[model samples]
Target: MRLYIAIPCVLLALVFAASGIAGITRGWVLPENRHRVRRLRLYGWGQLVAAVALCRQMLFSTVLSDPDTLDPHIREWGILSGGALLLTGIILMGVSQRARGARQGTGTP
Candidate 1:
């Protein structure tokens, strides 16, 4: 049960990071185009949320903690997911900015 939850959580994080990269690559061709990026961005963020929730579940699945002290595996998973979320968020933000600039006809980097 715990392993199952952990697997999806980490996968989601990786997916988030991968989606962000895809969005950036797509954005490069047409900076103003936001349709694909918007959809992918939502997926990425959703994955991050799911990852956190799933990871929390894995951590507390057995001897559920009230305060949720960090178990070693939980700590590592959390850090990985958090980093992926942060990186994806940053990439999405940059893409959004570029989209805005392109829409404004500025084409700012």
Candidate 2:
């Protein structure tokens, strides 16, 4: 069961990492889009942090004494931290998108 869950988590982390790198690289194509590049970098950093947290949790899952239970403080912290990281990454990306849209006159402020 844990293996099944871990596989998906790892895949998700990999996707996040890849997308973040792509965004960071894509930001460099134009000189006038400096702010867009900055926002993209911010979003990318957040996603990378999230990916790291998820990978850390997955790596530590095996050493945990009770994989099925969340009674351990360390395990609980890992879960909560991962959740927080994921949320932060999503929020950064959303803000970046909104800013980009507004700048393009396609979104309302």
- Which candidate tops lDDT? 2
State the lDDT of candidate 2 residue by residue for 6-94, as single tens digits. Answer: 88888999997876676676643234444454476776766677787778778556435375655577777876786777788767766
Q: What's the lDDT for all of these models?
A: 0.50, 0.67
TM-score of every model versus the real structure: 0.33, 0.60
TM-score of 2: 0.60
Per-residue lDDT of 51 in model 1: 46
CA deviation > 4 Å runs, candidate 1:
28-33, 36-109
* lDDT score for residue 75 of model 2: 78
Q: After superposition, how far is residue 103 of candidate 2 from its true place, in Å?
A: 12
- Per-candidate clashes come to 0, 0
The local distance difference test score of model 1 is 0.50
Itemize residue pairs with steric clashes in candidate 2: none
Assess candidate 2 and give its lDDT: 0.67
Q: Which candidate has the top score in TM-score?
A: 2
Give candidate 2's root-mean-square deviation (CA, Å): 7.6
